[model samples]
Target chain A: MKKICLGVVGIVLTFFSAYAQTPQKDSSTYKSRKLTFDEANLVSSYYKQEGNNAAVTGGIGSQKLSDISNTIDVKFIKWDRKDRKHSFDLEVGLDHYTSASSDQVDLKANSSASHADTRIFPSVSWLIENEKNGTTIGAGLSSSTEFDYQSIGANINFSKKTNNRNGEFTAKAQAFIDKVSLIYPTELRSGGGGDDDDDDDYATTARNSYSGSLSYSQIINQRLQIMFIADLISQKGLLSLPFYRVYFNDNSVQKENLPDTRMKIPLGFRANYFIGDKVILRSFYRYYHDDWGLTAHTVEVEAPVKVTPFFSITPFYRYYKQTAVDYFAPYKTHISSNQYYTSNFDLSAFNSNFYGAGIRLTPPKGVFGIQQLNMLELRYGHYTRTNGLNSDIVSMNLKFK
Target chain B: MKLVKLKPKVNRLAVVAVSAVAILSSCTTVKEYQKNKLNDGEMTLSSRKIQKTESSFQSYREGASGANGGKTGGGCGCN
Candidate 1:
C-alpha cells in the first residue's frame, strides 16, 4: 500500500512538472492595449484648368481657374480586453482657389474679392472592430467652411466579414447640412450697387444632402478580388447657384433656377487582378442616374507595374459621358417659357477623358533615410472635355509612421 | 450611329459579367498563406491615397458623382 501511494505521488509530480514546463499565456507579451499613434499622412495637390464655358458669365467667358490644396491626417489605434480594436482618424484640409471668371461678376472690376477664396475643412472618425466576430462599427463627423458655403456632416458605418473572411459587406449612411450664401451677380442683386464687403444684406439658404451606401467585396481567387457598390443620395433646398446667369432666347438674363429637390442613384463595380508577378490591373465602372433627367456612365482602368518590391508605377485612364439634364440649355438657348432653366455647362451633355500616371516608393529603409517616413507618392493627370475644357493636376503624398 | 457606338459598350459589359461569374464560380478557398498577391498594396480595389484630390476634383468638375469612394456633394466647387 505504501508503494502504491508513492507511485501515485510520482505521477502527480510528473504532471505538475509538465504543466510547469508549458509556457504560460502571458498577457504582457501581447500588444499594448493603450491608445497609441499609428501613422500620419500629408497630401498636397496643385490644379489648374481653363475653358471657354463659364456659367457665371452667361456661359461665354474665360473659365480659368487654379487651386492649391493640402490635407493632413493622423491615426491612432488601441485594443480592448475583449480583443476589440479601436481606431481613430483625425484630418484637416485647406484649399485656396482663384477664378478669373468670378471677376466678371461685376463686369467692371478686373479683380474682385470673389476672385479668390479659401476653404478649410476638418474631420474626425472612430472605428471599433471585433476580430472574433469579424465586424466593425464606425462613426464620423466633418465640417467645411468657405467664403460662401458652409457644411456640417455626420456619418455612421457598419461592416461584417464572411465566416471564411473572403468577403465583406459594408453599409454607411451620411448626412450633410449646408448653408449657401446668396451672392447674386452685381446686376442681379437687390441693391443696384453691390459691395463685396457688405455681407449683412446677403441672404442664406439651406441645402441638405443625405446618402446611403452599400458595398460588398469578395476575393474571387488568390490573385483577384471584386467589389460592388451602390449609393442612393437625396438632396433638398437650394440647388442653384445664385450667381449663375441664364440668358433666355429673347436676350433676357436671369439667375439660374432648378428644382428644389433631387434624387440620385449610382451603381458601381470594381475589380482588381494580379495579372503576373509584377503587374496588376484595377478597373472600375459606374452608372449614375438622377431625377433631373441626367444619366451618366464612367469607366476607369489602371495598371500598376511593380518595378521592385517597394516601388511601382501606375498609369490610369478614365472615360466619362453624360446626357444633359432636362432643364439645361447652352448660352442664350433657353426660352422664357421654361419654368426651370440653367446655362451651366456642367449639366450639359458632354464626354470627358482623363489620363494620369503615378509613382509610389515604399523603401525598406524609409524615405530620405528617415525611419518614420514610410512612403512617398507623386501623380500627374491631364483632363480634357469634348467641350473645349481642359485641366492639369499634380499631387503628392507622404506617409509617416 | 448612336446604337452602333453603344453596341461595343454593351458587349464589353456582357463579357465582363460573364468572366466575373466564371472566375468567382471557379474560385478555390484560398488559404491565408496564398493571399500575398491579393494583399499587395497595388492590388487594392479602391482608389489610391494619392488619388484623393483627383477624386475630389473629378466630382466637382463632372456632372456625375458617387460610386468612386468620393464625396457626392457638400462643398461648393464654385470659384
Candidate 2:
C-alpha cells in the first residue's frame, strides 16, 4: 500500500510540473520534419529543398489599381529552409506588374474612373523568419516605368504557448524612397511653360514613412482567436497625385484633391472563428486619421469552408467609407489661394464595396509527389463605388512544395 | 447646407450597424458548419509538431494574418 501511494504521488507531481511549466509550441507542427524526398516520386529531392508558389492577379478599381485604371501582376514566392537552430528562415520573391490607364480628362469626359498611364513594375522581396523565439524580419525593392522605389522593413514578435497559444506581441517598421521622371509638355505644367523640352528634368523625391504596430493576439478558448493591432504612421514629402485635374467653368465639378504631406494613425482588429470541421469566419476593421485633415474607416468579413478534403471555398466582403479633407473640393472649387486642393476622386468623400470569392484545390497529401506541388487556387472579385464606378478581378495561385 | 451637416453623422451610424450585423450573423447555426474535434487541439492551441502543410495554416502575410508563418518559415514581399 505504501508503494502504491508513493507511485501515485509521483505521478501527481509529474502532472503538476507539466501544468505549471510554461507550455511551448510543438516543433513537430512544421512540415520540414515530416517530408522526405524518398516518400515522393520526384526527379530528385535535391534541387534547393525549398518551397515555392506563383500567383497572377488582374483587377480593376474606381481609380486604376496602380496609376492605370486596370492592372495585372504576377508574383513568385519561395522560402528557403531554416538554419540549424531554427533561429530564422530565408525567404525571397518577385512581382512583375503592368498597368494601363486612360489620359487626363476634362469636364467633357468622366476621368474619375480611368488612368492615362501605361507602365511595368518589377519588385523583389526578402524575409528572415524566427519561429522558435517568435520573430520575423523583411525587406523589399520595386521599380516602375515612371518611378523606382525601394523599401526596407522589419518586425519583432513574441508569444506564449502555455495551455494554448493564447497571446502574442509584435512591433514593426518600414521606410521607402521614390525616384520619378518629370517630363511633360509646357501646356501640361499647370497651364503653360516656355519649353515643352524642359520636361526632361528628373525629380528624386524622398518620401519616407515609418509605421509602428503593437499587437496582441489571443485565443479565447477553443472556438475563437482574436487580434488587436494599433498603429502609428508618419509620412513626409510629395504625396499628391500628379495627373489629377480640377475644372471651374461654372464650377462644374469633375475631380477632387487633398494635401500631399500628412501623418496618419490607424487602429485595427481581426477575429477568427472555427465554426466546425470545415468552416471558418473572419472579421476585420480599421479606423484611420491623418494630419492632412482626412479620416477613413474600413471593415471586412470573410467566410471560408472546405467542401471536401481536396477542395475549399471562401466568400469575402468589405466596405470602406471616408470623409474628405477640409480642403477637398470638386474642380475649380480650389481658388488656388487654398494651400491644399485637387479633384482626384481618391480624395473625395465616397464609399465603396468589395465582394469576392476564392476556390482552392490540393492533390492528396503524401501521394507519391511533392506535398504542395499540385495545389491551385482561383479567385474572383468585384468592386463598386457609390458614384458609378465598378471593377472586376481574377487571380490564380499555384504551388510546389 | 443643413442636409450636408447630417451626412457625416449618418455614416458613423452606418458603420455601427454593420458591426452589429456581423456579430449577430456569427451566432446563427449554419447547417454546413458543424464542430470538429480536429480543430480543438486537445485543449492546447498550438502543436509544435512538424505537421502536414494542409493540416495547419500559413500566416505568411503582414496585412492581417501576420508577416511570417509564425514558425511557419517563408519569405514573401508581404512580410
Question: Given candidate 1, what's the lDDT at residue B57?
Answer: 80
lDDT of 1 by residue, A1-401 (tens): 23433443354334333444333222535755777767777787889999998999877899999988877788888888988889999998878889997777777889988888888899999999998899999999999999889999999999999898888999999999999988888888766424577755567899999999999988988988999999999999999988889999999899899999999999999999999799999999999999999999999999999999899999999999999999999898999989999888888899999998999999998787755667999999999999999999999888766
Global lDDT for candidate 2?
A: 0.43
Cα lDDT listed for each candidate: 0.85, 0.43
Q: Looking at model 1 chain A, which ten-residue stretch has the lowest summed lDDT?
A: A17-26
The residue-by-residue lDDT of candidate 2 on A216-287, one tens digit each, is: 665554477656666666656545433334454354332223445566667667777777678777777777
Compute the lDDT of residue A280 as modeled in candidate 1.
95
Model 2 chain A: which ten-residue window has the lowest total lDDT? A40-49
What is candidate 1's CA lDDT for residue A192? 40
Q: How many residue pairs clash (N, CA or C atoms closer than 3 angstroms) in each of the candidate models, in the order given?
A: 0, 24
Off by over 4 Å in 2: A1-102, A105-164, A183-186, A190-201, A249-260, A365-372, B1-79
Per-prediction fnat values? 0.67, 0.00
